[model samples]
Target: MAIKAKNLSFSYRKKKVLENLNFEIKDGEFIAILGPNGAGKTTLLKCILGLLKVEGEILVFGKDPSTCKKILEMISYVPQKSTLSTDLPITVIDVLRMNSKELNEEIIEDFELCDKMKTLFRELSGGFQQRVLIARALMKNPKMILLDEPFNGVDVLSQEKITKILEKVNATVLAVVHNINPIIHAVDRVMLLNRELIAFGKPNDVFTKENLFKAYKAEIPVVICEEGIIHPLYGDQHG
Candidate 1:
């Protein structure tokens, strides 16, 4: 298994976040986590990455993420694009060179970032910057990749390109996305979370009207496409 969370629960001070969550991710599976803001989606990812102290057990590749240093080496992470400073003076190449001794030319070409290699990180568009971050994560040659809202802010064309790049990645991937429309065809499974596991299965099975209503606490419309079923207007659930 790529990851296994058993009876997981977490709280910040007195506020409860996750509760009795349990799930398993298989090897090389691309899973998309969908939830409204403050549903503990990012917290779940952090727990898997061993960034936070949690109440239950989480195993990455059959090893504890928090205690095993080797597990950290097998993972790559791309955080939300908004978390990055666009005004930084560093170049794309500089970002890639930060942790890696040698650059992976293939990744640069694959992400279509060859031309922007010398451009300042802040000068590129949001989509290009995201690609740069993904490229940097690839430098580690990790077995698993975690992306937090990769398509949150970008043009339609950039979204398509980013989806394609993720589709071809040869690793276990768990990404947090606000909506499942763009990546409907790319991900193999869907995990709907709202401080708990609402549903988890293939996109066709889990993206149902009933499941979405439970997670979002509202009547969410589901569109049946040739690829699969998707929630067109998914976003922060506010009520």
Candidate 2:
């Protein structure tokens, strides 16, 4: 297994976020975390990454991130675009170079930033920046990746391209994205979180109207069509 969480729980100061969460992730698997805002999705990721103090047994390939020093270098993170500082006087390559340490031809092409290597990060669009962060994450040659809202402001075309690249990688992925339309077909399982693990299974099994209602406290309008069941989270829950 690439990752495992047992009885995982966390709190922000005194406000409880996650409560007794348990799950397992296999190697080379793509897992998408689904939840409403402030549902402890990002907090759970942070706990696994050892970014925050968490109370539970979190084993990243059987290693604790807090005690194991090299554990951190084995993973890469592509933070939300909104979390990035656009005003920073940094270049496209600068962010990649930070982790890469060494420049290579493949890096230039994979990120498609050879031309904009010198361009200011603030000047380029959001999609390009997402690619840059992904490239930077790969620099460490990690076995896993943690992405938070990776496509927040990316264009449709760019979103499509990045999805392909992520799948091509051999690393296991734990991503938190808003619109899963781009990766719905690519993911192996969906982990629904809301202070606790609501469900963890294949999208077809766990992404049901009942479970959606349990997790979001809202009914996701689903359409029965020739393609398949299309469920959308739009309407309020029936009280």
Best by TM-score: 1
Give Cα distance to truth, residue 38, candidate 2, Å.
0.3
TM-score of each: 0.94, 0.92
Clash tally, candidates in order = 0, 0
lDDT of 1 by residue, 36-112 (tens): 88889999989999888888898999988888877888899888877777687998899988658799899888888
What TM-score does prediction 2 earn? Answer: 0.92
Clashing pairs in 1: none
Candidate 2's C-alpha lDDT? 0.81
Q: Show where candidate 2 strays beyond 4 Å.
A: 224-239
lDDT by residue (tens digit), candidate 2, 1-239: 88888998898888889999988999999998878888887887888788777888888888888677687888888877777778999998788887778876675697688899899989988898888888888877789999998877888888888888888888999888655667877888888888999999887777788888897787676654465734444422221
RMSD of each: 1.7, 2.7
* Index of the highest-lDDT prediction: 1
* Reference-based lDDT, each prediction: 0.85, 0.81
Q: What is the lDDT of residue 113 in candidate 2?
A: 82
Candidate 1 lDDT (Cα, 0 to 1): 0.85
CA lDDT of 62 in candidate 2?
A: 86
Worst 10 residues of 1 by lDDT: 230-239
